[model samples]
Target: MRLTIPLLAAALGLCAAPAFAADGKQLYLDNCAACHQPTGKGIDGAFPALAASKVVQGDPKEPIIRVLKGRGGMPAFSTELTDLEIAKVLTYARVTWGNKGKPVQPTQVTALRVGAKGPTVKPALAH
Candidate 1:
């Protein structure tokens, strides 16, 4: 049987709360581990390694924007995950795998969400 967050949490005697209340590690395992792997080494060229990744370890906004924008094969989590969940997952990614970075907060995610813009279309030039 595949071990999921709730199952792992129950095994460890952790509470089975909603994703909003779940910890960063759990969120990461549930949502990102498939691609990024538990070791954060990722799947070579398919999925970039999160360990020591410049985007993951650099400014918080970088990861946040990527998560929200859906770069390459990475799906956009802006609609799927709550601000809190995104913050926790980003924080978890930043701090784990020997990476050193500041923790992201929901407020920061919210600010970015508010300021984020959809794709823009350029006006057609006269033919």
Candidate 2:
């Protein structure tokens, strides 16, 4: 009957909820694993290891800023990831690889995004 159909739809919706939830680890792997490595230990002399990194362990704002504005060689993610995605990925990194930092929230990311400047694009020197 109508009640049975509604109940079934509710059950199906609950089952599909996990699928809609963001997977932070997967996001990190897709975006950061290449440089940070699966284990979070970076390549010596090249990329700095993220495991127990000061930046990761420090205030969430540090990593948020870094992600939005690329450092020496790392690419900025401001254009690539939504605020929620950045928050999730930062939260994942903070909790993993022996790091004990607090989880980052989307609201925090949004605040940082509002105040953060975009990555600097250095102009080429005139010949």
Candidate 3:
């Protein structure tokens, strides 16, 4: 009976997809879907479509850095999100929308953020 429970648990694990405390898909929905749209097609003339976008499909650093720094109309997430959260969302984007791209590791995000260009927070006003 000692081996039975262990074997049963091991077998159950195989049947399930790896779970995360916060799933990548859900993270994308919460953060990106509002602008990008659930379909990833995005709003025309407003938000750019992530679906099959060459940028998203290109280097992982490009998207990761864009998210961290914020380009043009996009707001920066450097302070709002963690490295792992950024990685998960970027990975979800790159892998989804039928775009062929490599997965972005959390370490890569950390590496790119070694010295952020600006202060992470705004200075409080002096009375």
lDDT of each: 0.76, 0.77, 0.74
What does the lDDT read for residue 41 in candidate 1? 98
Q: What order do you get sorting by lDDT, best first?
A: 2, 1, 3
The C-alpha local distance difference test score for the whole of candidate 1 amounts to 0.76
Best TM-score among the predictions, by candidate number: 3
Model 2, 7-93: lDDT tens per residue? 997777555334322467888899999999989998999898988998997898989888888788998888888777787788778
Q: What does candidate 2 score on TM? A: 0.74
For candidate 1, the 10 contiguous residues with the lowest summed lDDT are: 118-127
Cα-based TM-score, every candidate: 0.74, 0.74, 0.75
lDDT of 3 by residue, 13-120 (tens): 433212321356898898889999988899999999998999998987789888888887888888777887777778778768787766666778887876557548
The clash numbers for all candidates, in the given order, read: 0, 0, 0
Q: After superposition, which runs of candidate 1 have C-alpha atoms over 4 Å from their true positions?
A: 1-22, 118-127
Task: Give the true-structure RMSD of model 3.
Answer: 8.2
